[model samples]
Target: MAATVAQPTHMTRAKHWNEEVENAYRFQLAGWRDQVEYTGHKGEVTTWPNGLIKKLMRKSDECWYYFNKTRECADKDINKCKLYTY
Candidate 1:
């Protein structure tokens, strides 16, 4: 007789972002870039873009502020932005 194998009843799934979440983040980044260009002083114009880019890269991982409160709407859906999705 062949031995029978049992499969686990529960499975873990990975979360991912849908098009909406992606577009929101992209729009936020673009707005930040625009702000870097429009708000910086004349002397700081050349350097501010680099600084803003670094800041955006670093802060992009922050869940609370990344989507700028849009996370709430995405909270209910796994395909939307969530803890690990970003």
Candidate 2:
């Protein structure tokens, strides 16, 4: 869809996801474009109206992860987004 700048593949998703986790509470996040710049990362950076990284691990919708891109560390740690509860 033109609305979306890039469609991250399974691999990209995994890579980005890991990096995001590694830099959990970080604030300045390296957007997907930064990861696989050769691919559509650039496009995603430009086209995406709002730069929002879906911090998901267990693969569940309606989950809102509170990640501090500035701190480079997830507030609740990877897979510990402040979205849902058990």
| TM-score computed on alpha carbons, candidate 2 | 0.22
Q: In candidate 2, which residue ranges exceed 4 Å CA deviation?
A: 1-7, 11-20, 23-28, 38-71, 75-77, 80-86
lDDT scores in order: 0.32, 0.31
Question: Candidate 2, residues 1-86: lDDT per residue as tens digits?
Answer: 22334433433222234444453222223322232331232232221123334342211332334443333443345443211111
TM-score of each: 0.20, 0.22
What does the lDDT read for residue 4 in candidate 1? 32
Worst 10 residues of 1 by lDDT: 41-50
Residue pairs in steric clash, candidate 1?
none
Q: Of the candidates shown, which would achieve the greatest TM-score relative to the real structure? A: 2
